[model samples]
Target: MFNDRPFPVDAFPKIIRNAIYEVEQHTQAPQGLIAASVLGVISLACQNRIDVCRLNNLRSPVSLFLLTLAESGERKSTVDKLLMKPLYQLEENLFEKYTHDLTIWKNDEAIFNIEKKALMLKLKSDIQRNKDYFATNEKLKDLLQSPPKAPVRFKLIFNDATPAAIKDHLCGYWRSVGIMSDEAGAIFNGYTLNELPFINKMWDGATFSVERKSEPEKLIRNARLTLALMVQPDVFKGYLQRKGEAAKGIGFFARCLICQPDSTQGSRKISSPVVSSEHLPVFHQRLMEIVNDNITLDNKNDRLCLRFSLEAENRWIEFYNKVESDMGFFGSLSNCKDYASKVAENMARVASLLHYFNGNDGDIPLSAIEDAVKITTWYVNEYIHLFSKPNEFTLAITEGDELYWWIKNHCNRHVVPYITKNTILQYGPNKFRNRSKANELLNMLQSQNKILIGKRGKTTLIAIANLKPAI
Candidate 1:
């Protein structure tokens, strides 16, 4: 199916457009591919900040899990390097600061423990004396109550990390961070990724507790994560084959804004001129402004928040109602209704991200909200086009389709309408080592009015229905 409503390119932020133009100048990739990369950069910069804002009485963390599908030579790595320079630079600076601070903290913590042990001994002695003990005990208790605050590392980016490691990073470093990978196969293909419980919880900004026998239970709160990954379709298909429907059942894929860009392969005519370096400096400067903002902690030591504008709120109400109705009514989105249902929330999140890109810490504007709506709609349509099949049926449908194509190609080459049982059993699509599986596919194709199956002299035969003459 064609994507009738393509991405709203004009609705993207000016900086995003500029960034895309810059990359396309050199990469010769499609605009959508470049735009998706730029969006990843924006998502990384503003995931934590705009998550503090609310729309339509619903406050959602602005964490976007974006997956851009392209072939190996689509220049995904090139675009990622160009767009993600600021984040890498910021992470480097943060590492330097954290290293220095951690050293100081360890020193302070060791000294404080020594002082605390001495105070405990003195308090014990005073209690034993039982005379003038009350005053001394009170002083020691006061001192213990105000122990030094522990220092925290502030990190923003992680690559190829396990959920446990990510939790630890979010708990020890900044409350918000991103898992960014150019080759997403590392994250998706890793065995630990099958049961991604942490990602499911963190995306919702829900609090989680990790119990440890050797240490105190760790409570994680206000955790936000942005995911940006570029994956080859073959790798993603392998993931689907390995994980089956489990990934979708657990809402792993549902959380992702998947973009399958039309290939730019075979389109490169000649080397294009390099993009001007001037655009990136300003882009980096703006990104740095947000990164440098002081993240204020709440009473619970979590980040503070902003709210939505009146116009934005009203628009959300309308959009939410429409999408809800479409989900209930539209057959096209039936299998992906769970993901499609989130379009409104995701739009508001994108709007908040765009709003914060301009360094605004206040209400999200109607303009940004509208633009987000357009973009989210495009994504939802794309999602339906790509993943509209029920999880359980996907494997069967995909296999059946592949079988049809393989048989068609083989028949055309051999100039035969029907394939012999022995040949098909050994060399057919899916190579029916299990004859029952081949029968199942034949039954499925029969139901679809695409093929006919018969048995002759203990040999099962397959033939295309309404077979066309070889051209």
Candidate 2:
């Protein structure tokens, strides 16, 4: 029961949809990759500035955790680079400002240290001589109070960072950040995944204390973080093979919106026209506007809370109940109950992102929630397709379906009326490339009347039953 539906690109706002379309035309990348990249950028920009209010009055950050699984030459990096241009430019500008500010602060800090040393000497001498030391003590107190303040270092994105480094940055510098990478082998294979509990807490937006033996304990409060990683299919499967049980036990994968799309490798043409420079700049401008607004606020942690309208709330509750029911013992989503449980909240988070990114100021409308549901439902099905274990009958159906598609595609491409069984056994899907397996699936399809098996001059030929000729 692998429901491999295409991603719902039309559910996105116009700005996002246009960008995805233009990028797909230019790069010929899978729409799933482009959509994931666009959503990652939206999460980075909106996570710090907006919060979604659930029906229970509880507020949650709109940050998202995305995992994209593709093959090696799928152009994942190219898609990411195109969408992340604004963030790169912002980081460069912020780094320059920080460097300038650091220089001035260093000189002021030197002068303050010298003055403090001299004042301490004078105060000690006056105390020993029993002279009036009250005025000197007061002067020293004033000097300590007026010591130079260090400027805050503004950084928005990190590629490969340890859990400790991430905690330090959020606690000591900016309260909002994103950990994004085109190749995330370091993150999945390193110490970051080892600390699942820490990452889970950050995703929950919970207040937690990080205690160090050599320094004071740092408290992380009202901090926001977005994690988006793109890795090859084999690497991700290896991670699951090693730590699948632990990850499920802690509900780690339950927090992620994972996508693994069919590759578009051979279909991309070198002569494809270059993308019009129009759509991406609009996307970049909108992203910069939101980021700049977040930067200029007096308190970075203060977020604008968005609530659902009455109609939207009713729709949300209905969706919640539907998901809950589907997690029953015999329901479609019963295998992945953890993911099903969290899908509603993820839907709300997505709706909030859509609402805010479109510059809507009022409560989240029904249309946004409806659109979010369509997108999130696709993710729900994708999760099941990737992670769920199918019974024997299900596996047979899946294999038969794959073989059917292969035969149909081969016929259409080569303009052949029938395919030899030997050709299928040689070039079909790997699962059915053997003699015994090929016969088993071919017989099954013939019984279903979806394909015909016949012989031409002592050679077995396979043809798609009633497949219309190409126009």
Candidate 3:
């Protein structure tokens, strides 16, 4: 599910055509009638907007054109292009439609405007004809309730009894809990908005709520002794409601985190689901700063360990080899033993901070020490081998001179960086071998380098780089 392929645009036309065919076959209408009504629906697409009512007629012909493409299974790939042509055609004639000698409802208008009205009329006529042939099923009658054309109800309640002290304890309180719901409103449908303290009130206040409402009257009136057992029970709870200008933007709703189902009933989920990009800018920047500070803290003097620094000028240099990083541009430490030790110690503090936050093992390991040695050795070889054509990797992780010459030969001919890993990535060594992953990587390597030249313990005697780029 994480990596599902996107639906191919080319298949859309065919997919829509099939849906139309399936619906038509089920309805058993004359082919002409079913096809015509489908076209009408497509043509009406551009007219559905409440704000763009002026386009009601103007968009009909364009909508019809889209449906035409939808019907021609092969035309799906160009669906957007097909739809844009008619709209652009209309745009080009916008001036003609507006410049009128005298105002009459239908007379003095652009060609696109006139065509739009004509298409809509055609759509209406076909729809009415198809409507008469439909079966008189009860379900159909029930579904025929024309959507109530009621004007929007903008009136809302915003009374809060929460003490100013408790409500304002935290800066993000209103958003943290559904507090605004406990407001007054003209009673509607026999239910009223609830109001109660959210903070400093536990379940002991059984009626305790930030805001809540009783269930529907029908559910309330017929309660019996076993009613609670008979039903799941309509819950009374505090929920968010918008007030003033806030409601206009948010449409009168409270998206409170505490009131969410997953976080209800004394059991609160830690960390909400991964947040969206729209709200992540400030969060991520703060997170990065914390990480940077933590790393700086970890690299303190006390933590610069050096068990793997047998060849290092100092102990702290070892730990510097780990943590390739998400983002860092810190300069490399000097070879001077004292400076390397200081840098390593400082880096260890950073590692410690990471461990503390993640609640996991945060120790500097022996494998990393070994990997650090390998990295140092590779750095030395890089200077001398910089001009070697097809630079066969010579930095052997666990080897003597024979393995070194074997690597040198491959790069001496082909123009590739021949290299091997001691510290596989920024994290240092994987003491635990992952052969399958290694082989998967091997398969991606030059196929001609198939022969395993030799072996060192469990590790393979293979060229790290040759004709291919270095690992």
Candidate 4:
């Protein structure tokens, strides 16, 4: 909804004209009533923007963006209307959508789809429009060039989250498939999958200063294949060694999908890795379902995505010829990155791999992922839980739910910005509620030895203590 900053187009004029008429409507009422009526008029006029864009499914936050761009009005009534009306409508819409379906297991494709298109269009257009800025400003355009073999940050919570019991009831709900254990609370660990095609798309978008472009996709493929083979070496590997074509083809697809060297960036805008299985039919079916869901709802964020992408395949080939090319290229892919965000990202991806290899996926099942998010929610009620302050003195790592998990706990009351995958600002400490607390947290971080860096719209702090050469 923003491009670091946004440029208001037509919405500016509408606010100006409406303010004049609002003052006229409230002349006769008493001072209190007049004040309230005038406020109401301005608010209503500004909100009629749903009519202006004709987008019924507009997100609550986007309206605020448009309103911010509204011209300042002189009359108190007009000003108040412009200020508060959009917010009111936004609250109304959000309340209706959340309450009816906030239950554990329900297909949220409807909401997801509406939100996806709105965001994707906004994001894509912004990138396309600013092509010139990126071209001229060498520094800005450089942001899109992904490093080799980037890791996917996977956040999975594994308490008592199970899907089989809730499958019939939930849409986006992920439940544990087999392990029916009360001991488990819920799991929410962030994973970073590699990006394949997106790398190509971004490279294509960039000035093409990259070393190798055409064959980049090939190296990208080998990287994904290496990872998939690594994903389940004992069981799935022996099978893939024999299957030949399907193995190669699916390997290629997986290579392209996961946004990792071993990962394939699948057709869906949603981020998920291709896991090998003896049950191809079931896997295929799930793949189609996920793709369909992604098509229907994938928004600007791709929702949450891995910055990692397959090095263009062709580039991989040259790299192989020049390099060891053994272990199927794991060394080439695991190279530690210099970028600040990518540094932590590599670790998160490795963490997901640890959880995934532990039979957590099939054991826990997919539906529980969202359920696992509760751990993050509970994390914010106070602090100093198991995950809280783990690396505070060391890496300065603070525990909490990711932004989505945080916002969702509030039923996405308003859009909460994310800083990387795991951290976010909780809504509670706003000016009206625990303001001092929020300030204290922010000020404390700002005053610390480390600096905070934001990525994908969220603030992330770097702990000097966490620094280590690539593990």
Cα lDDT of all candidates, in order? 0.71, 0.84, 0.26, 0.24
Cα lDDT tens digits for candidate 3, 1-471 = 000121111221332334334433333222222232323222222111101101122110011110010111212222222222333343334335434322333342444355555555655665677764233343334333432232211111112333333222222211111112111122111122222222212101112222225522211110000000000101211111222123212311111101100001111224444433332223223333332342234222232221222332234342344322211345232222222322333232222222222222324343333433432222222222311211331221222222333334334423345433331221112321255544454454435453223345654445543334323
Which sections of candidate 3 miss by over 4 Å?
1-3, 8-82, 101-471
What is residue 168's positional error in candidate 3, in angstroms? 41
Model 3 scores what on Cα lDDT?
A: 0.26
Worst 10 residues of 2 by lDDT: 389-398
Model 4 TM-score on a 0 to 1 scale: 0.17
For each candidate, what TM-score against the reference?
Answer: 0.74, 0.85, 0.14, 0.17
Please list the Cα RMSD from the true structure of every candidate, rounded to 1 decimal place. 8.8, 4.9, 32.2, 29.5
Q: Rank the candidates by TM-score, best first.
A: 2, 1, 4, 3
| Candidate 1 error regions (>4 Å) | 1-6, 52-56, 112-150, 271-274, 294-307, 329-331, 360-362, 389-471
Local accuracy of candidate 4 as per-residue lDDT tens digits, 196-229: 3322222111111222344332111100011111
lDDT of 3 at 119: 51
Q: What lDDT is reached at residue 32 by model 4?
A: 23
User: How do the residues 1-471 of candidate 1 rate in per-residue lDDT, one tens digit apiece?
Assistant: 124444577786777666666677777775667777777778777766556455435667888888887667778888888878877877788789778888888888888888778877887887787756776677678877877666667777778766777777766646778878888888778743644677788778899897768988888887777778888867787787778478777887778787776545434556645556667667778887766663443324444455668888888779888877777765556667778666777887788777778666567778887988888887887677667743422223456654665565456545688776566566553344467877687688879988777777787677787883232
Quote the RMSD, in angstroms, for model 1. Answer: 8.8
lDDT against true structure, model 2 = 0.84
Q: Considering every candidate listed, which one attains the maximal TM-score?
A: 2
Off by over 4 Å in 4: 1-315, 319-436, 449-471
